[model samples]
Target: MLLSSFVRKGLLFFLLTCLSIHISKAQFLLNDSISYQPKKLTTLGISAGAVYGVSMFALNEAWYKENKREEFHFFNDAAEWKQVDKAGHFYTAFYLSALSAQSINQCGVKAKKSALLGSLAGFVLISSIEIFDGYSEAYGASVSDLIANAGGSVFYWWQQNHWQELRLQPKFSFHRTPFAPLRPAVLGENIPTEILKDYNGQTYWLSADMDKFMRFPKWLNLAVGYGAHSMLYARDATNTANGYDPYRQYYLSVDFDLTAIETDSKFVRGLIKALSVIKLPAPALEMSKKGVKFHPLYF
Candidate 1:
């Protein structure tokens, strides 16, 4: 339950920060005439620091402070959630790194430097939460989580340095699942929170920029996705004992690249970039232990 809360809060903070930063600093980001503005860099740094501080404080108050404190410790949760939570960590970190790099670039930083700094920033921001878990009696810091976080940041840096663009982008999608209603406390009670807590409903995707590699439409992407089903409990054994057999779900689908849309408005472009994290509904093929299925329109 707390793990879900952690994922939800961290994702929300990163997304909100990205939107606010881009909107508020439009002039800095949109202006190409200036290549290295010290003022802009400083302002961005201060703003990011402030946001980080406030977010950490809020997380502590909301999730950890109420629980009993314990000596800092490590936890082994690699077996939990069929590693879906780990995938969530990787997805979140990837976006956080991408957003940070984009934000820094807007402040006139060079792309290479921005990518490195942004990757570091992304790792730091996500891993900081582990400190909270380490001290909480209810949970311990997870090494697997830290590894996933690092993988996300490194993946962003690797793509930016090698391709100068994200040829393969990580994306996410979710839908209300019957499993959630079976475990409302662990999954969620409402639509919004359910999207965060319900691993059974969430799908993490790797959308390939087909045009970058071959003769394909720039607006179209071929994607592979990962998800889990019937995961009312973190462990497969517990879920099976409760009459739910947890299993992995894999998908092949097509995705739309909003950034490919030609728009003169900076706001529109930023909106597209921000919203691009979500995988739009399209035809998909699902393969799982239960059977193979097809969806004409899958979210």
Candidate 2:
């Protein structure tokens, strides 16, 4: 568990770093951000249909185990399985069909036919899953999941038709921290020329370690992080004699976009894009700080 936590934290940190860069860069591309065009409607429909059909068969075994009964197979309980014990089986097909429709739409499925085909695909796919789950002892099918699937299909279509806004910033930001790590290598030359002359009394710019990661700004897949690091007193120079450095040498920084989407950038677009075959959900961004100041778009 401890190791897992460390790994999880490390992954989060890495992702945060990447998002910071992605968003900063996306801010620059001043074009119609939302691209809508469907492709491969039928292919998605067929594939989803077949997969869900097979899945129903597996669910029968799960359902049998869940009921504390001997494992049941479609062949073993064909008569009993025919009974509509599960309510969501139909809806499962619905959602799958919806998903398949969405995929086809994304893959260049056209309108009218595309919408029809997408809807058919969703119904068929989702219903097929329901059938599979009907037989599972561990997992049962319900109308609720199917209803939810329909709602989801509608939701996707609503967004597709009325995509209010899109702000994908797959950009990179750089906040070089020269003042950090003042501890020079031990047994080395005392205060190298570059260091002594540079950081002695100069007020160095303490920006984020922007280069450490990039950002993922596709649609609303906005991931951002303002480097929260600190500036510590060098061991050689804690405090000069008696007069305290008064500036409170403790180092801490917090910078990030304050927006409506900050709460779930990773949950929505980031996860969806990752699960998909999207190679460039977040294209590269132009990262150099533009003239425009950062402000909350929703606010």
Candidate 3:
């Protein structure tokens, strides 16, 4: 039922591609030499398609096939983990759309063309995964997931088309938790595995650049985050029977925009761009069913 790893890898690949494009473009601009070839654009499109096809096939065989079959159907999982998975879906869609658009733009595609195609690509990539889940007995196609995916892609497209920049970015962060050990079979058998499967340890955030709206530092951001805890089972009753109390966690924190740091080195810029996907450590105020608490440092 946990498919974060697949989506994470897809996002990582797109981020890397975007970083590479930025670095290469920076170098070209520095040299006062730049050119766009239709052949290169065509090749990039073909390669992207091949990658998507191969990834889908591999994921279907390695993960989805392990689950039992089910009648094609839709599921309502909007309330799962207080919608943490939904946030993750949105995060994935937003970043993938932005990165895809940047990658296409680098290939000499027109801004409008690249933005439209990239947004479509991002929406399709995330939505296609639902088809796999729809056939698996362990999970079903979720309309909530599709809605989140659309929200993310549309956010990116609209921002790029109007503002021409990302003033608000979706980010993710995680911290190891002891709760995973309580249910290894369901959570994970190892730390690496648990980090991906355990919703209790994962947090999804939206970091907004305050400078976009007011006089503020460009590198500083106000972030709102969502996470969960004590969710070893899908049902609260099951978790309660296991002596666990499930609760949703909400956070308000300060974040940094690594990409906003002034830098002339292309490599540094690329590295910053890649690192920007992560929510930086900072003090946070958390509100949950247990009430409010403060963290000196929250990931």
Per-residue accuracy of model 3 over 1-299 as CA lDDT, tens digit each? 55544344444455436434533432111111235668877877787777777777777777777788978988787766657777877887886777677667777777766777788888887788788778878778899989999999998888777766667788889998887788777667787767667788889888898998899987789999999888877667777898889998999999987756677886786677667888989999999999999999998
lDDT of each: 0.81, 0.32, 0.75
Q: Candidate 3, clashing residue pairs?
A: none
Q: Rank candidates by TM-score, best first.
A: 1, 3, 2
- TM-score per candidate, chains pooled: 0.92, 0.30, 0.86
Candidate 2 structure lDDT: 0.32
Candidate 3 wrong stretches, greater than 4 Å: 3-36, 65-71
What are the runs in model 1 whose C-alpha is more than 4 Å off?
1-20, 23-34
Model 1: per-residue lDDT, tens digit, 141-213? Answer: 9999999999999999998888777888898999999877877878888897788888889999999989989
lDDT of 3: 0.75
TM-score of 2: 0.30
- Model 2 agreement with the true structure over 1-299: per-residue lDDT tens digits: 11221222233233223322222221111123325432343554455445444444444443333453334333221112111111122322333333344444455544334445655555444444444444545444545545545653454344334432212211122233443245333111233322222122222112222322355322233233121122223222343343323131111222232232334455554443332211122222222223223323210
RMSD of each: 2.7, 20.4, 3.7
Q: Pick the candidate with the highest lDDT.
A: 1
